[model samples]
Target: MKLPNPFRKREYQILTPATKVDDSILERPEFLPEEEVKRSGKKTAAKQKKGKQLEGLISYLRKPRAEEGYTVLIAACIAILFTVFAFFGMIQAAGEPSLTVSAAVMSAMLVSAYGIYLAVRALRDKEKDQLYTWVGLSLSSLVMVTWVIALLLGLTT
Candidate 1:
């Protein structure tokens, strides 16, 4: 029995090269020319030591990627911790100078400053994403400004 086909055939064409290609273009040579190999021999001890010395710094700088960098993320987290400390100090205030609260506020300030530093560093890195960096910087700046205003008001009274 003859049946009607529901789908039509899709037309396509296959292509072939007119001439043979060079094998060298397709494969890597076992040995390169002297001029092509800039550093043919093993690295000297001094160069190896220098590389080892800079390894830590290089890795730290390399953490910045196409996505948000780790330093900026860490800065944001630190700023959040500063906010927590600030709120805790405010809530636990005894209306008098408390050593623990004073310490907390100071520590929070220092940590937030460090967070701002990290954010600035991350922002300076051209390879890193700046969204988190800006967030961290703004939050830290806001908290610092508020703290300064509060301190001023306290001194005025």
Candidate 2:
């Protein structure tokens, strides 16, 4: 029988012949010694530095405050007062009948238009204060419209 080939055997084996490696390839250079690296550590100088602060006196300017709520309240109140006045004026004008009726109607329409304009402006802007403004304006407009219509129909004064 023929002998089995050693290369074909299923077993671990060393392929290369043993030889001495060059010291330069196998070891770190002399300049990059472990002692010097350990002594230097990993600390950075930039991280240890402090930032600058403002030195001289400074003045800050602010804008004037707006009384949006007060404005809205005043507007609504004015519309209401005007409506009341118009109602009374119409009642007094009733004696003259045809003479002052058109004038009273025109005044009422104007007030109602102003209120509607305010309400529309407030509704278009999404700010919280403006939202409240719009609501107040809308309510005032509705009141004025209702009273004006009633007056024209001769239902109320």
Candidate 3:
């Protein structure tokens, strides 16, 4: 005769890389779905961070694997560098810029071209996220527009 105990639990098995699991025995009807099959929904911390980093700046870069994201990313990198350079140049010059306004305008225009290029690529692809492309385009267009306006107003010769 056997008596049932409410507190009794099945033995726990820990699986490691070296552990051998029996495939045939796993087909038995006693196991739960979770026990029979592992889960795939888990994500690594690195992948989560990468996805966050790509969200606003270059989410579509993974899909087409095109040059648009690369170019835009490069331009953004250069812009950050230019900002640092401009800051130091201004400090060295005691508020008067060592680089002429015209030189700055030219660099801005060149970088702005990359933005337009990315936008056009996004639009023409017809298979990518269009809104992100347009947003990126507008940012570059604004830069070019501001430069043009500055040139027209004689703010930068």
Model 1 segments more than 4 A misplaced: 1-69
Tens-place lDDT digits, model 3, residues 1-157? 9898888996566763443433445443334374333443223433576688878794445555444655665564554454456446657778566556436657767777777776677577766545556656776777767666756886545
Q: Rank the candidates by lDDT, best first.
A: 1, 3, 2
Which is the better candidate, 1 or 2, if ranked by lDDT?
A: 1
Better of 1 and 3 by lDDT: 1
- C-alpha TM-score for every candidate: 0.49, 0.39, 0.43
Worst 10 residues of 3 by lDDT: 37-46
Collision count of model 3? 0
Q: Write the per-residue lDDT of candidate 2 for residues 1-157, one digit (tens) a residue.
A: 9888888867655886455542343333334566654565412222232122233434344432223534554666665666666567667866554545555555655655665666665555443345446555766677676766666787645
Candidate ranking (TM-score, best to worst)? 1, 3, 2
Pairs of residues clashing in candidate 3: none
Q: Summing lDDT over every window of 10 consecutive residues in candidate 2, give the lowest-scoring window.
A: 42-51
Q: 1-157, model 1: which lDDT tens digit per residue?
A: 9776769685455695644642343222224454434454322433676689988874544444524345555655665676676667667774664676677667667766776777766676785557667876787777677667878998999
Find the candidate with the highest TM-score and give its number: 1
